[model samples]
Target chain A: MNYPNGKKTNNKPVTNRKPKQTPNFSNRGMTLEEDINQSNQAYLSSGRAVIHKKPTPVQIVNVDYPKRSAAVIKEAYFKQASTTDYNGIYRGKYIDFEAKETRNKTSFPLANIHEHQVEHMKKVCEQDGVCFAILRFSKLEETYFFPAKKLFQHWDRQNNGGRKSIPYQTIQQEGHFIPLQYHIRIDYLSIIDEMYF
Target chain B: MNYPNGKKTNNKPVTNRKPKQTPNFSNRGMTLEEDINQSNQAYLSSGRAVIHKKPTPVQIVNVDYPKRSAAVIKEAYFKQASTTDYNGIYRGKYIDFEAKETRNKTSFPLANIHEHQVEHMKKVCEQDGVCFAILRFSKLEETYFFPAKKLFQHWDRQNNGGRKSIPYQTIQQEGHFIPLQYHIRIDYLSIIDEMYF
Candidate 1:
């Protein structure tokens, strides 16, 4: 296709082209984690909330400190996380949640959520902390803020010989949809305000 | 010197000796991190609070995922943590703190803490989250729960040509001493209950 700026559609790799300054609303090719991270940066800068993704858990078996350089990990293995991926404080309340994305448009598979994570969420809920899941249906391009209580119910039902996944229609009814924005890609705080505050 | 287990005072390199089943109150050779982790586990099991120390941050540059085998990180580097080492919920309130130990008996040096961590504590305090530091003096064998506000005061004062470290006497007066116990090695939540609750 011809370009609007009077340039031909160049198939040659445009290595020197500068990145776009403004964000494109329709072109959301970024992963859910990246979107959430960007949104968290916006929230933190705006003094709305203070959320951060925990680093990937790694078990270091051996490390070498050579001369005056930085320590380098020689032998390490990734460890499974025992808690949710994201946590912080908002409006004097503790917030905790896990983010997950699936390509299945019909349902969100139960396998996406781990048992220990559910247990962690249960403990947080018992402590009266706000715990939930940010589930994204990638194929459908829909993201929802699903409550931990509802997830627990479904998890229990699955353990009791129920369906292994939550249907999209059920999620639409029970969960709050998070709309994308320019600055805050996934404005989940607005949903929290409406639901909790 | 000999132990009270009726064993001879033979120094023949006892490598096969069994670990003690009961905790010793006098001999605390474990690091402050281990002590806090043990305390957190105790609190979690008793359903008192849900606190966890964050895993050490690392930057992975290369990984090898062989078939039917776990992923092995071939190259990685240690990364500086942007936030405190530990945080979680206690009594429906957000709790955040950093645990640090000093071998020097005079003062807890500011060099142990990073600038970004102080900024993070500032943000957490602004969000009304309970923030503090667990300072331990190895020589004195004392641990104290120093409030974030107090730390910030000293931090800012140091920036304005004040002392670079907080004096040991100052910590004794301003901080709450965490007593070592058999079950909950470092009973910090007790101090939290007294100070915040």
Candidate 2:
């Protein structure tokens, strides 16, 4: 027997596959957002820092208030965020960053970021906030704390006809590698402490 | 003629009344959100600080993408925010605050706030962020910057069977009055400058 995609029937169809429900303990299927959020929760619980990912921006066009139930948004659109994703206070220092996960193993593309977000980061940097990007290379299973100052150099260079993506080697050199941990999955705050504190 | 409410027709029916679109150059009808947003824009343009009101939280359940148009959120619901409405970096300090407008002449009711917001504020304060509440007494045309520490006192007192509202007189005594300016309408940062910076 053969599958629709011409593979042998021994391999199940991709659509028929479901995530295993067994109680296995590993961060194999988690996204970067989930990892950072869990890490933030750990930090918050331990009084290490107070950080939060801002909610996804949405533009509501219509809403219906049923008699007693909560108001339901019937029509809406996702909005382009005017700022970075995560921001909070850490030991009295303003912390701000956008998190991005790219499947590409060779380079982190600048297209992953928006222009106004970059402008917002620039303003945050001017205000002396510890602003940076949390870049996760999923294929390589590596994450880095890329500072806004270093990112600005690359952003400006790209606008001036330079490479559109930061070379993986360049990120390895300019950005601090964020190691995965047992409790705090992506321990980016450790990097912040070593660099800013 | 007589209006449906039985008032004399010399006055236009209340339901039919519309705000004059004559672009009257005045801040007479602006809400607290509008005033603060404009003030934030002014602050951003003048290189003073980077502050922004976080977008309203929404939980999207379903979305539809047409052939060419943008994705449309077909089902969603408003979510209770986990943090303050406004937060940013100002003078190298993490500025966190929630803005509220009340028409009551005697006091600002504690019911206007949520328990989780207080919890979030406590965490921000623990991190030494400059956290506060921007209270606007619309009826009195007065705005005040009430520090988070002072707010915590009233909150605790209320939880312990004290007054459920902070009396207007008490606010007048403890909170710093935020003067309305042409550019920075709320002018809460000026209070932060004096108190924190």
Candidate 3:
């Protein structure tokens, strides 16, 4: 079979054994990062939005300037990002969000988010920017647009002996489920429109 | 003499040299970058604004993992940034700007800004984000907040027998002059408030 980007899939189907349940199209082994990137590209190309994933920060310690072409970094280390991964202007409002995927079936663990990121999101929200987390349950093939305000409520309650993880039921009830689309892939802005606009 | 950051001045005063006019206190031998960073830090601490300098992007080519320690990137290359150097949410709006310093006292050269950066700023402005360039005349110790709209006007006219640089007099007349403060350093936000608010 041929994929959308013209790469031919070579995984042969095994007909000798009993067939398993139909594959989950939503969880096609492509990560949430790739899906969101494709969606952002679509959004940018259509002039609908201008959102970008920030490059991973690396601290360079040394560099070598060899003759002409380009200077090469010889020593570096990955640094923790102080803010969320995605941010941009969307319809005259600042849009900022982080994305996380969890394999756990029942709950979204708090460990998935860094304290600094939570604090950053709080500041962004305080500035009245549209802030949220894109939570993906890979095992359940479900994705959600979880608002930062709701996340803050859970984050604060954890200090007073509340649950460390958000129960799947709460997410399903409160979070907006991001609908999957053909070309758009993860259609998150539609949810934003419904919630904010 | 001691500098603001506690570094001892080593250069002796030259009594034989012709007396140059008293040095501009605003420049203070500090790069525009350092000033902006200090300003941003103060803004963050005071809850006046949420702005940050984006990390310089590097492309990792190789990594080495030593026992019981974090993985170290052994080789990488500095990557050109696709967007402006600084961006953040301020006053419920997206703020993006690039800072440039020039020693020329007559005009700010167009060569200091990359074509792609100009395109990026134009796009940001089109999206209703407050986009501008912080132009510093290092020799004159004057800094101006040049709006991207005004910049685009000059940039586009360069093809039609227009000057290749923005005259210092024009900047003085059109751009908002950023004042230097003790703690705030380059207080560009005041200019933003005046223009945007």
TM-score comparison, 1 vs 3, better candidate: 1
lDDT of 1: 0.85
State the C-alpha lDDT per candidate. Answer: 0.85, 0.84, 0.81
Which CAPRI tier for candidate 1?
medium
Q: In candidate 2, what are the lDDT values of residues A1-197, reduced to their tens digit?
A: 43234533232221121222112223579999999999999999999999999988999999999998999999999999999999999999999999999999999999999999999999999999999999988867777889999999999999999999999988888887766655577788888877866
Model 3 error, position B97 (Å): 0.7
How many clashes in each candidate?
Answer: 0, 0, 0
| Winning candidate number (lDDT) | 1
TM for every model, in the order presented, reads 0.88, 0.87, 0.86
Give the Å error, residue B10, model 2. Answer: 40
**Poorly placed runs, candidate 2 (over 4 Å):** A1-26, B1-27
Name the regions of candidate 3 deviating beyond 4 angstroms: A1-25, B1-25, B159-161
What would the per-residue lDDT of candidate 3 be over residues A1-197, giving only the tens digit for each residue?
34455654333222111212223335577899999999998988787887888889888888889996799899989999999999888888899999999999999999899999999999998899999999988877778889999999898888679999999988877787765545677778887776778
Error of 3 at B113 (Å): 1.5
**Docking quality (DockQ) for each candidate:** 0.70, 0.66, 0.63
